[model samples]
Target chain A: MATPVLTVKGLTKNFGKLCAVNQINLQVNQGEVFGMLGPNGSGKTTTLGMLMGVVNPTAGEFSWFGQPPTHHIRKKIGAVLEHPIFYPYLSGQKNLELNATIKQTDFNNIAKVLDIVELTARRNDAYKTYSLGMKQRLAIASALLNDPTVLILDEPTNGLDPMGIAEIRTIIKRIAADGKTIILASHLLDEVQKVCTHFAILRKGNLVHSGPVDDVGKGEEIVEVIAFHDDLPAHLNQFQGTKEVKKDGQFYLVKMNNGFHSAELNRFLFEKGIVVSHLATQKKSLEKQFLEILAENNTH
Target chain B: MLHLLKIDLKKLTSYRTFWVVCGLYFITLGFTTASGMEFLKWLANKSVEFGATININRIPLYHFPDIWQNVIFVSGFFKLILAFMVVISVTNEFTYRTIRQNIIDGMSRTEFLLSKMLTNVLLSLLSCAMLLIIILITGFIYSPEIIWSEIFTDAGFMFAYFLEMFSFLSYTLMLGLLIQRSGLTIVVLCLSHMLEAIIKANIDDVTPGLIPFFPMESITNLVEMPFARYAFQEIQDYVSLTSVAIALGWLVIFNYISYLKLKKSDL
Candidate 1:
């Protein structure tokens, strides 16, 4: 495997008496869209802030590209923490120019990045005059100015309209498709599950669960069926490749082995003289898994 | 360092209030110097007798060695106008949160503090150069035959004026750092005058000789009042070395506070 683009070990931060971030260890490798998922106040922002060098870590250490944390190292990485940070007086192009200057990058790329964000037309408008979505777009555009290999975004879609959120997600996914390592922190589990290739769940500054997004709830293709009559799901285990079956209030959750699918199950149920009224092949959503992870961690 | 200042200048040049206040400072410098010269010319015409028959123009107020003190002392009053620019520049980063953005963009805390100090130095140099040109034109316009040798006589006051600006900027920067809002910072700055007065009154009441040693007071004392000499009143004849040292000391302290705050605090 390639070297980890970001290696955070025992990263913790405390705001006086409140431990904003406890010991959290995480590693994000190159070209992987790694999402830090948690609910509000779960320290997702603080962890991202500490990684971006905005909030000083009370304990532990982190590094970018195997080098110590320094301005030079930071120049290689692009990030936007909790808020959309820009001088509102400047034009969109001017704000990106400022970012380019800070990174010691070329000003020529400002046009290209503006185009990427679909903000080339509004490039001359002052940042204050832009809408809220435009401001967030501008922030992401600035983060892309240096053509950084690693992008860190904290709640990129927070407070954005649906259109704005879709636009940002498209841009982010495009960048990720281009083989850039993206470290995103969000409370939206669906967003993370959709955009990220790997994920880590944070609860009160602790890593509850983390792995490949595809690895979540693997080895089971559960199907939920609702029928007009009762006593039909009790014989579901008699079907071939059935692992387990359970019923919960007007729905039957059939845990099937790898060989069975919803179509096969429907045909067998029909052959068994049972008529199906509703059948939905259950796709285990990250939201359910995330809440389960949080609930389990809470009990411990 | 130049790159860091370039990073700062990129933002500063785009900042409107920076240029507005800067324009105000130079304009005020020109208007005040011209008005001072014009008023002195008016006094020369009025032939107003201060005691009995002495004309104000005959008092050598615009002469070479004396012109330095007169110009610098008046120009120093306009430091507030320029100091407000510094206040805005520093607070702009905080209010807009560009400082945190800049830090995330690749500027370290020390580089951030240094960029501001460098801008303060740049402003000091620019303002002092403008002051020099104004003094030269006004002095040559009103005074007798130029004695090239006496040009450097009161030049120390000119240097003192630059230090005074640099140090005052440091103080204003500290205020900006401590209070992040522009409107609030300005209010606190204005209120600080009375605040300083109260503190200095209480402190100086116990130690009689320490009032001149105050931070802002020492900066203001760098160039003694030149217009007051027109009233036939006594002033600090020479630039007080003690005051300059104290002002420089305060400058170091203010910058230290700014750096420490930026370094230690989570932006």
Candidate 2:
């Protein structure tokens, strides 16, 4: 059994009359890349803020490692919220030294983290003089200094170019490979699909969908089959496993019912003596599934 | 607490504005105290040359017992410069959002506030040390003789000056926490100072004894105007325990309110 790293129950946050985060419960386990997927104003940052102990929750509570949340507990969890926050007038090295001071970690770790972020060459430059991508990298280096068991990053690649985003994702993947639990919040579906082992989606402060990334579009199967015989499309409609079939030119798009597999379909067609010219199966894209989830739970 | 102080010093030592403001305060306080007598003698000479027949040199401004009060009272004006430094430092935490970062990095809100308070204590102690050195130098150079017993007789005024500096910095710290914008905080500080003076003046007209209870007035009363003795007029020659207690009470009140503000706010 996997050990639970973080458990949040009935977590809610309301700014005056506007509820920023509704009653939401979530649990993340050890060595899992948990992605918090949401659009703008969906309270992703607010939830992370509360977990970091910077924002007060309106209702409910959370714990780290099955213990109550406290500042001391936070030392075991590293986090970056919204944007990179550091003294602009101080050098990247100096800022990390200050963060190290606050965390009571060894100053020797600063050099190692900076080297991991590939910022060792420019560590002495003032923070304000660095580019946005460099600033984000420095934040990651600071987060890594504590050697935290769980690293939380909100929008780790929010405003970066394509190359910058790739660089951050590579670093995240490298860290996650070390058996550390990571909680990453981002609106990019592609990012979550690529890096996260599990994900939860939020819409307008409400949790709409959550589960393992592998479980997405798992129940049903869709197959595209083409045959030289024109009657193949007609035969597909009568198959017990077939839910719906649409013809496009010479190919028949078969939507299989729940629990149906492409092998069963091929077997059924072979028994019918229908030779197919082409056969392919496609799992639903996460982008389509995500949009469908949001569309299904569009109560707000 | 020492660790918190170290963290704050690291944040401050690399910032140019912090050094600039501290340097400005050091020079202002050092120059004003060191050259005060010469400036007065120059003015006395100009008046003599102008046929005004004034003999300002006869006044013993740097006398051993009186020098403590004289030096401390003059240093009060420069304390506001230090107050501005406190304001800028505290407000920069907000402007840069480092306060939020600090809290996220395993620091409690109380720890964060305590770190800033520690900085205040450090600044106050430094100011006092500079004052002690300058006052001793000035007293030994100009006094007729160094009476070891009398040299520190008026040193209670130095304690009062410390209370004055510390409590005043606490007041500015509260202001910085309340108003996160440095420029706006300074503006509010100045406006409130004027407003407090006006209120104190009006309150003195009806209840003269109650004026010392106000926050700013209480701090100011800790170091009462000692220059009145220069004109041979009556003055409170030493620190009063009642005034010290009042200032101490206000200091506690200011720090408590600041703590509440930091605790309740969503940094």
Model 2, A50-132: lDDT tens digits are 99988989999998999989999887788999999999989999999999988999999999999999999999999999999
What class would a CAPRI assessor give candidate 1's docking?
medium
Chain B TM-score of candidate 1 stands at: 0.92
CAPRI-style grade of the A/B interface in model 2: high
Best by lDDT: 2
**TM-score against native, each model:** 0.92, 0.95
Comparing chain B with the reference, what is the TM-score for each candidate? 0.92, 0.96
Report fnat, model 1. Answer: 0.83
Write out the backbone clash pairs for model 1.
Answer: none
lDDT of each: 0.86, 0.90
State the fraction of real interface contacts model 2 keeps.
0.86
| Model 1 residue B62 distance off true place after TM-score fit, in angstroms | 0.8
